[model samples]
Target: MRPLAILGDNITTDHLSPSNAILASSAAGEYLTKMGVPEEDFNSYATHRGDHLTAQRATFANPKLFNEMVKENGQIKQGSLARIEPEGKVTRMWEAIETYMNRKQPLIVIAGADYGQGSSRDWAAKGVRLAGVEAIVAEGFERIHRTNLVGMGVLPLEFKPGVNRHSLALDGTELFDVVGEIKPGADLALVVTRQNGEKLDVAVTCRLDTADEVHVYQAGGVLQRFAQDFLAQ
Candidate 1:
């Protein structure tokens, strides 16, 4: 892949996607706290995203609520690296996604094993796709998340065993090239090229393991494919 953006090693899908409990808290805690979501019944972050008031708050508020290995004001950094509006608010991954979405910038996520391993929810892929992620690359994958990605029409790629982001220094800016038609178990080439002109060529497997998957991805998503078929009849 030419112009491939690289990312660091050991990123899981959960790290890429927020958990329901955390998502619930992140979704509602901000505004609700001010309007009084009642700390007791504030609910999980995943539960209240349907409510814009809660979702907006949770989106930004969450970067301050979780432990992302770095702490400020007693809150760990959780979201993406954001320039945080107002000149200085907490910056986190979710907030970064929120910012990128607002800017209409296309995104790509890179990670390592058990990627997308925890849950089987379609929201995991939908959330990222909605946030404008065009594709994802990882060292390995969890079965369900891999399918969910294809179902959402997001590309899921697995790096060959011996090569990963660590060796490539992928950090979300390197562009990737997935050359050749993607097919199940086919060895696809991922050419990672840094902005400064350094490059690393690696081989990865196409996560879409079936003919049906290729069809689904080509059609945009499972639901879209289904709708198209339904309309055809």
Candidate 2:
């Protein structure tokens, strides 16, 4: 079980992950360096997919690192900070996920309303999936971004009306425990426990709306799902 890593309401994909065109020699660059990717061609964080170095570099390469970033040591800081582990230093977000992706760790993200509300970029989903994010639980979601998550084999969940992160007291520091199989409109319990020993249980509804979504997710992605279906027939 991984902590849900909650965020405040109205977090767009651009905020969830960095989107600008410029890539600085920050945490993302450091990961790129480890992966042998030159810092000059780092490009946007979006372009790093299929390459570990680029993705890790861009994890914190956001030119405009949101002020909402909550550091691992329980301190939220502006801009990117290097996540230091026994494996050396890596971008914070990527560092959290690198452990999981390589070891096949199960992960989840918790957020407030309007999650994934931004450009309908597939990389938004790809990034999290590559990082081993199995699911996202938020107060709400944008239509396209939700689909994008499903397309990438990541689950998107919504908090019930009148129930939100505020009431749950989630501060992006709690480890979340999600139960049940992914199904359209399925009910699941999000178990969150804070560092101070506080516990929060949030009710969530699965956002995948169609059987087609299940197919895409089960096949690991839209293209793979399509290819399988096309080849079968």
Candidate 3:
């Protein structure tokens, strides 16, 4: 996996999936319009989350998102923007996700402090997984969101004390290797190799804080585990 995007601190659940009024220019709104839903009928993302088609479009749909990859005239532009690595195309967040999905690429999101600090919602976890994100390495994580990620089978890792995205010098131009085994409260190594052959190992803590969380993650999320158990019985 590689760094899909580098995000800042305090990235809340709403940033991952906005629940406010949907605007015509928003991804969810545009998707609804294309599906023949009238402008006035388009609802908030929180309402249509049951429908994955419309909900997935809301991934990273936050208008206030500040993706470092998006640049204009040598300045970091705001909004739901993403920079596709290697090819280096700066485009809308969803478009970049679409490209990665089509390429069958795996993704890893690197974030700053208090990652996933807002409302507790599974869509925040589901949306990123649907985008093909395999894991996330952040400076820190909100407690519940960490569990939610595990429930969704999305690996949640944390940078060791005093370490962060900036300290790693990750510029979204590297391949990441999550090296080591999975265990509750385990310290893992995130091997990052840069484009110039520079490599470094960053120590990260596994966010599967409990044994049950580990089991759930191993079974590919809560529902999958339940299904497996049910079939066995």
Which candidate achieves the best lDDT against the true structure? Answer: 3
Error of 1 at 65 (Å): 12
**RMSD in Å for all candidates:** 5.5, 4.1, 1.2
> How well is each residue in 1-233 modelled by candidate 3, as lDDT tens digits?
86667898999999888888889887778888899999888867888978999889888888889876666886778898888988988888888899999999999999999999988988999999999998999889999988889888999999988898788767788899888889998999999999999889888999988899889999999999999999999
Worst 10 contiguous positions by lDDT, candidate 3? 67-76
User: Pick by TM-score: which candidate is best?
Assistant: 3
Residue 163 displacement in candidate 3 (angstroms): 1.0
Candidate with the larger TM-score of 1 and 2: 2
TM-score of 1: 0.72
lDDT of 2 at 18: 70
Order the candidates by lDDT, highest first. Answer: 3, 2, 1
Reference-based TM-score of each model: 0.72, 0.76, 0.96
* Candidate 2 lDDT, 1-233, residue by residue in tens: 46425566676667656756534445666655676766677676666666555554354344444423356466655554433223333355555566656776577776777887877766667777776778888788899989888988888888899887677755454567777777778888777777677777777897878888977887988989989989999
Whole-model Cα lDDT of every candidate shown, in order: 0.61, 0.67, 0.88
True-vs-predicted CA distance for residue 58, candidate 2, Å = 2.6
Output the lDDT of residue 199, model 2: 75
Residue 50 lDDT in candidate 2 = 62
